[model samples]
Target: MSDSHPKVLLTGATGFVGGRLLPALLEAGLSTRCLVRSAERFRKPGTGGPGFETVEGDLLDPGSLARALEGMDAAFYLVHSMGGRSISRYRDYIDRDIRAAENFVRAADAAGVKRIIYLGGLGETGDNLSDHLSSRQMVGEILQSGRVQTTALRAANIIGAGGAPFEMLRYLVERIPLMVCPRWIDTKCQPIAIQNVIEYLLGCLLQPAAAGLTLDIGGPDIITYRDLMLIYARARGLKRVIVTVPVLTPKLSSYWINLITPVPAGVVMPLVEGLKNEVICKDNRILDLVPIRLIPMEEAVCMALAEISEGPGRIPSMQSCLIRDV
Candidate 1:
């Protein structure tokens, strides 16, 4: 690594995507700093390693975020609120997501940071977007408002150990032999693997083309939620059946998911509602810029399973999967 290598500030370092991203950023030889809520969390097994500097901070608090943003060349915004009980009542969700982005942007500007990289969801803009996707888009806008260059990577269902989509698929396939699928099940989605997402994030750090841009990243295969379940079933060596019923609204589907999977009604509702919209990437601009060979869905699923069998904390698994589903 050159002396000119950027010192990167990473938020959400304890979360699923951030946890996976930490190792990748370290391996890439970048000078890395992580913003964590509690320093004690960093002492846990599989949390820290060489090349990481952990600082305590809270996104909800601008002062803390400003302190964390000091002396960094760039920052990654990877936080989201899905575990909350009621998505509708989460004023803090919007406030924290938007305000945190804004504060980070302002702090980065004050610190003379060069760029901001954010990971958001993939969905068509307009009224069709779910609350989660809408908030994610808002975060991107907030970050871009600052003078610093911002790169936003929008992805559809990310398939990996510790990702929400993978955990949902795992639970649904493992728990329910016969799934009563909703209309969203047939909706098309481009699911990217965790490895590919990490690749894209790393690529952004070096690719000038990624600056001040929003890029869509997806896997090589464009498949449906139904297709995802089938692939998982085949991978797990379990024969399962899906019965698509037309009358099941997103609300009812969420209830069903809550019953069958480890995902709560709050998380499942937005995720299910979002599935109603097809999430396939509309452009290949990212390919021209990052030029990564996307992994196939089957291979991604196999890798996730392999990680799961190896043991806990090696891979990020949903709390629900470990406690309720598995």
Candidate 2:
């Protein structure tokens, strides 16, 4: 690749956010290389595109990753082990993420990659953090271990199609007329649209200011899960009541989620536990650095609904399943 048009390596191209991001990267006229576990999984027969390549590699395999990272200017680390059956054990989840990140970072460093961009969860910097958030933070730390500059974009609930929180809200609202809400349902969270998130990720790729910084990304509004349910109910023209009970623990909530939604107990438990922490954005440093118009909650919800209604585009069902499990 020419110096003017740097080659970028992207991990998790078959994932939910990565699936949306691939078209955006192509549209931006950047040379892109995606790493997938299976070559067949990354193949798109009819969609002909230039400056796009796919290579079979796993984060666990250092040799394949080193080859994949060769000649790449920048890399995007978008992989997470949220859907894995072993995520129920906090130590296993942390170990997997840390090891994967370490391997990727070492490979990127050896390939002389300029930068690494990571997407992580948003939560307070305290010992009381949920396991999911803790693992995300640890991954960010692991990525920074190498000499390559890393940018960590910590975000709260991302409101879009194929996201866990949004799908959970959709299932809860669509399945039950009345919700027996958990205590965490009232906790505040800042939600950003999938569009805005894509913009932020791409912005970091283009903006020099985003290098080696941990920036918080969120929407213009902050609302509780209950408030979100009410908005969704209003949008769908459904009347529903939420009865909050302090007795419903994360374990109990996971069991209920398994029964009500398509999400499994193993996946839902950690996500439910994470809801205990309020994940609102702490500062707007990213907004000042990489300026992009933020989308409102209602508009974001509408766009997600439209995308869901339109059926699948380039995004795969496996990606959707993985996202819901997250």
Candidate 3:
């Protein structure tokens, strides 16, 4: 590894956001190493590249985490298992995340890693948050408790292909002509583009002010979940009618989501519950700090649909508006 670029240890390299971030980090001249449960996960076609290495490790295994964190400058903690079939119970997933964070923090501190960059969920702290959002915030707090400087970027629904949120909206609008939405669909949120998210994650690494900070990263538009489905429908050239019904419980909504969308019941339940709370960003300090143009909801939806049509490409470097963080 070269001494010029930071040696970054990236977890969740095989997951949606991490998979996109992996190449972006490398393109930004960072010396990258990924921590995966199995090294073979990176050996598939279009998954390998030069100037990056993979280490076999699991966040639950202290020994493996220690080995993985050795001689790393910073670590990107992007692991979450909300949608996994192995999560028998939602509460069990929360416990797993906390345990993993504890193990990772201990190992990172022992290895003398400088910082930890985390992507967490967005929602006001005392809003009777759902188990899924609560677990996300808890993991961020656990990461901050460690000796290393931690930067946790809390973001709302990310509009990107292959993401759970995007897939859910995509399937619902594409399959159903007239849909019955729950009351939670009216909850307000600031959905961001996946491209902008990568920019923020990369920006945090390059900005000294980002250390030991918890920032809200969101797109320009503030809209409800209902608006999101409508925007996605318009972008895909589909005409869909949505009617809100207050009688549907989270359990029933989850079953309906499973029947309509490819997302399973286990994943659908937590997500549907999370939609009950408003997740709009309360702060906009990231705009002044990072200086990238915020993509609007409609434009973001169109871009996401375009990505799905053209297939994935290397995420281009976002032109920075400010040369240095003030």
Instruction: List, residue by residue over 241-295, the lDDT tens digit for candidate 1.
Output: 9999899898777766777665555566667768887787877799999988889
TM-scores for every candidate against the unseen true structure: 0.92, 0.93, 0.91
Error of 2 at 312 (Å): 3.0
- Every candidate's CA RMSD: 2.5, 2.7, 6.5
Per residue, candidate 2 scores C-alpha lDDT tens digits across 1-326 of 12546678989887767777777888788888989898786644233377888889999888899889998999989888666444346335566777799889988988999988899999986948998898898899889878999999999888887776778788889878988877988999999998999999998888887889989999988999898888888877889999999899877887787677665455576788898999988867998888999999988988887777766552442446523322
Total clashes for model 1: 1
lDDT of each: 0.79, 0.81, 0.81
Deviating ranges (above 4 Å) for candidate 2: 1-4, 43-48, 85-91, 314-317, 321-326
The list of candidate 1 runs beyond 4 A from truth reads 1-4, 43-50, 86-92, 316-325
Ranking by TM-score: 2, 1, 3
**Candidate number of the best TM-score:** 2
Stretches of candidate 3 above 4 Å error?
Answer: 1-4, 43-50, 86-88, 311-326
Q: What TM-score would candidate 1 get against the native?
A: 0.92
Q: How would you encode candidate 3's per-residue C-alpha lDDT over 1-326 as one tens digit per residue?
A: 12347799999887777877987887787878989887764532243467578899999889898888888999899888665443246556778888999999999999999989999999977899998899899999999999999999999989877677877787788888998877988899999999899999988888878888999999999998888888888887888899989898877887777777666555677888899888988877888889998899899888867666654433221111111111
